[model samples]
Target chain A: MDTFLQVLIAGVTMGCIYAFVALGFTLTIAAAGVVNFSYSEWVTYGGFFGVTLYSIVGLPLWAALIGTVILCVIMGYVFQWVVFRPLEGRHFLTIVTATIGISVSMGALATLVWGPYPLTLPTFFGNGTVEFGGISFFPHNVLIIVLAIALISVLQFCLTKTDIGLRLQATAQDPDAARLMGIPVRRMRTFAYCLSAGLAGLSGFLVAPLFVVTTTMGFGLMLKGLAATIVGGWGSLKGAVFGGLIIGIVEALGAAYISSEYKDVIAFLIIIVVLLFRPRGLFPERIAEKL
Target chain B: MRILSKSVIAAALAMSFAQVAFADDIKLGMVIGTTGPFAGGEAPLVNGTKMAVEDINAKGGIKGNKIQLIIEDTGSEQTGAINAYNRILDQEPSAIMNTTVSGFVLSQMGTIGDEGIPTLTGAASAQLALDKKGVEPLFRVRTSDLYVAKAAARFAIDNLGGKKIAVLRANSEFGNSWLNQIQSVLTDKSVKPVAVESFEVADRDFTPQILRIKDAGADVVIVSGDPPHFVVAVQQLKQLGLTSKVIFSNAGVLPTTIKLYQGDSANGIYGTVDSVPAIDPARADWAKRYREKFNIDSDYSAAEYYDGVMMVAAAIAKVGTDHEALVKEMRTIKDYAGIGNTYSYADKGDGGRSVAIVQIGDGKLTLAATIK
Candidate 1:
């Protein structure tokens, strides 16, 4: 049915966004051994940065996106050096708490600078709907899905086939062993943080036109990303993507068939069911023992 | 006889001191949500309240006593509102202006009634507020959601000829109230909505909901929600290729929301508003001044709050800050025209029944018809 296809496409589009943010969560957790709770705020900052560049400064979409990435990367490094670095050798709980503090502070800062009203970004792709096989889809939605898939594939290739990727893997596996192999483990961790932040920023930039840009926007995405990571598998990139897609499709279907009020509840129920049946998630991280 | 006279004199002196303390300056307490979900409209409400106080004082103050406004921020939660109400009560203000959220107002109704402080709310329009017994001291400056919903339903069915309607609303007090009223009015007209969906205030994706509405083949979609969410819903509805007519509740009349979707996506979306200053030259001048002063577009909240503050000032001036007298005076106010709308309280303290249907036109709200 066209309605079913439309819902499917919509779910996939949302799932892709969840996957991007989940990728950030998995990247930070894998590389740093501490979950960056503030990862979603990076996405929010990225959107605000895009608003400044595109809406206020009148930059082209691509140029504004590039500016957003640069700013987010710098912010990632600044947060790492300023907040996470000093607590590097401290207890894991300390780092997590610090990340929470960072998240709150970043949200408050965004609100202070931009106020609470949501800002609009110019649509990059044309706003027209394209009909394909009797189902209508927005060009922007298609672009988002394609871009998310491309980004994920590129990240996958880099993680599997590059020297820096190997270094990152080594650092995440065992910092002491990685350092012994002359892998500059700390620098690799910083690099992972930057990449994760950049991904979050990119997701924000891409989704801003679809949704309104607000400081609280990242919080919802962060929760969804966390849910995806939990449902897929901790510290598994592929699992995060799969988890995000699963959440998106399940939520859409649940809302359509059941009640819209329970859509979020359905997502949480899936997380619980996954945790109960397989604590390691739907796709358990298998490389730990191998590494 | 001498000892008893001395005690009476001391008691009289204490009572006189208390009266002097109360009369030093007329204090009005304001509870506004400056953070959390409601912060989007906080700036204008606070600015309007402040401007009203300034306007009053500049005119030689109420009977030469300067009106003082003590503001408290309800962090957009019931507990926060209750706490702020308690703090405001500690100041012993002559009257209180509560927050915009109906849930917060409902939670504090018993307390407001027990304290017998004449309270005015600019935005909370839940019918439950009026349905409750013992809410005598509570007054609403804005029209109730029930009234606004009736107007919206009439416009959609009567004017737009939307036979098959779909209702989409946020799951909040505001949304729920509007839903009930719209359903009641539509049922009375023997037209039932094809589909009804509710989303959370923070929800960004309405694709699933829109798809369902599209499938139902509704001729028009009636929406009731806060800003940005409404804006996103409209955009999504357009994107989903559902060319159904869209009608919005009073909450959707915001200029900022219209500007967010100013293109073809925003055209022909109808909404009801308490007032459109462009219709009245005097109101237009006030709106212009308010925009210049606050650097934000003037919405119903700003205008209603300004009028609310002035109403409190007027009551204080007429009754000299007597709590019971002030409550009586507020109820007795009849057709007191403010910048936004006229205030005339019914026996139960509900005011402002005038509304206008406005359609989005070229990034602005153009008045279509006035309903009383």
Candidate 2:
């Protein structure tokens, strides 16, 4: 029973990370109607940016995180203006291919700058763990869970309640009509892209201390985030979170009960099963339909 | 006009002869992954090889003929390795050094056997490489995982007195081979591991695995993984409060790895190493030279490859670059001391039998015991 609880907590912690990455995918796909295959590189670059600020530049952890966010915001805008803006109404495959190219280029650039060795981030929590009710939790894990929930709550509130959120939703649903109604659809799209990039940057910053920061780290998370987005239903924010949690818990349980070798296989099997039953996803884009 | 034409033809003939004479230099081909996942290890190997070539050439060359090294990047893949091998064969190299990855080296066995070029490798520590049927020309400078595992098992049982052991290995060719050898050694000693877990190479979170190991009440944890993964596991182990004596395979003995775990937390962790520069002044000097040259800290891979290059140079000098003569000379080398270890190729082409047990003490690698 204790083992089960510990694994559950571990799974949830990992699920939160997946959810954060998946949310980045969700926001971009909803806004642009194209999947950003290079979204994971944003996470990787963000983590390395933090490494530069914290380890190389000798900034405090909080300052480093802020620097990462600012850098990611600029990166997001540049990617939009330079890469996506030119490809605006082109073939969906063309945009995705460009994103893949971006991903590869970023990985190469990182390797050229930092070399292939993985870098370590100093943990803010100093390797401390908290035990309560016979459950032991690393402070980093607790922080990840709490921060993920808070970020998601803020995102949900903004998307559902704010006027800009309505405009963003309006643009995603029908850019033609949104523009006809005097809404700046392009601006909303850029804003959504920047927001999504910020979320990915935050996830990267949070995960670096737990794992080694390497250029390839984002590629792995990209696959997981794609799996989550697919399983949860495309363009469904709440579904992305659920999909991530489900993937994480199932992987942990599979590793515990079945075999670690087959954990990834089991997670993909769940995706297959979900696709077979719910062709669209567990939660389809109902908001888009309503709009 | 006829005299001018005749002069041009004569000059062209002279240039051709000069080219042939320049090509008479002994050529040694090196296939390494200078770019990709194995780049970290191969970079140092390349530097060490260059240093050996320079040192040999500075001493009036081997047999008064300057050695020419032809380097090709394997890109850490079998296809890339095959392409590199083909390119090297085009140059008609007298000998070849295979890449660091075992799988890539094994993939090139047919070519190595058919060509019969004298080959030496500092990587590819799999025992099967020694026992492979078509590896007659291939020699290993690095000791196999079997020896490292035997040394680790003996230390765990005899030195540390660990009864309930836990084995956590990366799911890789090297890791699996080491795990099997360690298990065999432990089973012979009438002890079985309390828990066994395997993680993928890219896995970051080991919380569930470590928790399970702790639940099994293991007194010792034997880790077989690469440096980055090993560092993460050690940090996670400390975070989870599992104070079991951790023993690492040779893969985790890099100085940079130790730097990641500096201070008290790093103390008492044991690992098997091929060489520690602090134990020998000659090795220390070699390491210092390497650092000054490459601007990076040297590891066992660099030392072994340095010795390999020197051995090849000596062989070329003793016997001309004839394939059969080079092979025979390499086989006859007995206890030829190098920067890393004294290498003696057994009948099966396995050399370097020395393995040392070392502990991380006060942010430094301290020699504990030598296993021969």
- Residue pairs with colliding backbones in model 1 are none
Model number with the top DockQ: 1
Candidate 2 deviant stretches above 4 angstroms: A286-291, B1-20, B23-28, B60-71, B87-94, B125-128, B320-328
**Residue by residue across A1-291, what tens digits does model 2's lDDT show?**
877887888889888899999998899887767688889889998889999999899999999999998889889989899988999888878988999988878876777787766676766777656887778877888889998899889888888799998888788888899999999989998998898888878888998876667777787777888889889988888888988889888888878777766778888999999999997789998443431
Q: Scoring model 1 with DockQ, what do you get?
A: 0.50
Poorest 10 consecutive residues of model 1 chain B by lDDT?
A: B125-134
Docking class of 1: medium
True contacts kept of each: 0.44, 0.29
Error of 1 at B1 (Å): 24
Tens digit of per-residue lDDT, candidate 2, span B53-143:
8998899788667889999978667899999998999999888877878777778888888888988887645643556433768888777
| Over 4 Å off, model 1 | A286-291, B1-25, B90-92
| Full-model lDDT for every candidate | 0.82, 0.81
